[model samples]
Target: MKTDGAEVLSKTVTQDEAAILDAWNVALLEGTSLQSGRIREAELQTQVKTVFGQLRDALASGGLDADAAGFASLRETLADISRSRAIQGFTPTDTANFVFSLKEPIFDALKRMPDGDATALAAGVWAAGKVLDRLGLQTMEVFLASREEVIGRQGQEIAELSTPVVRLWDGILALPLIGTLDSARTGVVMENLLQAIVDEEAEIAIIDITGVPTVDTLVAQHLLKTVAAARLMGADCIVSGIRPQIAQTMVHLGVELNVVSKATLADAFAVALKRTGRKVVRQQASTEGRR
Candidate 1:
């Protein structure tokens, strides 16, 4: 049977080599699998050659100490592969599998260390795990960033609004705040909200925070800025669904949200209708002040 390059690389691993090669395969599958099969095959072939060359070089040196050096080189090769594979479209399971496979060789290397060197090796292994975790997180972030870019290029009419958990009754745009609000997202939210306000010609914007787990002073400030920008565009922004914990944090941090209107989404809708001169009751107040 004719095997593709990826299949060829997979075939190169023996029962003994499986554990070491597993992590590299996982990383590759995670980072570059979204691309063409030919691209993935080419990248995997290069990675396998590099790792195999390292192992061959280490084994060629003749000494009792050669095994330890070989293991160290293998560990470094795994780390390199893990880092290189940190691209968008990779899954967490792949990353986890790769990291788990390293445990055995890492422990083996630590065991072979000199008496006083054991602590250093253990620390090094721990650091390597952290590096892998960071790489995985960075890969996911790149994926999200790419998604945002695609959405941006699709144009306003075709771009679908992000559905929030709650929406206003009077067609107000809803902004669902979630995760850590770094400066990058802050800018994105600002641009998106403003453009949405203009595009939809919406009179009210309801920012619902039911999904946000926590808030800091910076995030609070970002929210405030968004509200201010909306008002400048002649659109009222209502911040609703603030969690009790986030409210407390805002108070503790001494952040004042004075200008931005605060209420539940329903209440904001009521207020927005009132601002737009849409009376709940069409009939004017009776002369006796009875509806």
Candidate 2:
């Protein structure tokens, strides 16, 4: 029976599965030894065996195309492996090398096939290379996509963490703006402040922008929107941390924040306390001094 290159390569890999796996692992380690601590060799060995087993089965099934329906399971497995490696801090080269490294072991197996001429061996090697190349490219694609998702989620978490609502007093909530207020961050800020107000049943919410570097018309509009949202929630809003430059810019830009304004958070808090009919007085010295 005259078998094609794909059949010859797949049969050899399945027959010498253990040796091929060992060689593949060695090649992979050689390529990524610098990242030795990122993953364990044993775990990598298991994953290697799984992927190789799937590849061998698919090739033996007479479908050399990596994207064929027969290779769907293999592609899914590679995507999972790529995503895992990406989250484990593996570089793209390291991730794709997981598929590429198998090429050498399969090629070596092809060369050692019994009764096979040099031409046949080369053909088998070429076929295996094309398949592995396709699989490696698939891995890289999945790696990039997984990395993007991780970055997006991390950015969202940072935005949420940056916007925290604090209860300054019983009837006062403070949202200290620290970074640039874009539309997205403004929405998060408004949601957090409004939720805090309802939860605390607060009557005043102070938005302090001491950390804000500049105030443009857009920023003024965001502040107004937040103030409007808080007022709709039955709480008055105070805007504080108005530097001379920011005040000047707001006036020049014809941007009006139709809410109580203060130059400092302390002043805003004091105003809130007075509006809520609360007072903070210093304790006098004991009368023993007068005695």
Choose the strongest candidate by TM-score: 2
Give Cα distance to truth, residue 60, candidate 2, Å.
1.2
Put down candidate 1 lDDT per residue, 1-291, tens digits, no spaces. 332322222222222354455555554555534343433666665755575555434434322232255446655665555444444334445533434444454344334444435445545455435433443444344445555665576643232343322334454777877666667666777888888787777888888766667777777888888889989998888787777777888889888776555546566667777877776763556566554
Name model 2 segments beyond 4 Å from true: 1-4, 31-35, 285-291
Model 1 regions more than 4 Å off: 1-171, 279-291
Q: What lDDT tens digits, residue by residue, belong to model 2 across residues 145-244?
A: 9999999999999999999999988979999998899999999999999889989999999999998888999998999999998999999999999999
lDDT score of residue 264 within candidate 1:
64
Q: TM-score for every candidate vs. truth?
A: 0.43, 0.89
Best by lDDT: 2
| lDDT of residue 266 for candidate 2 | 95
**Deviation in angstroms for 37 in model 2?**
2.8
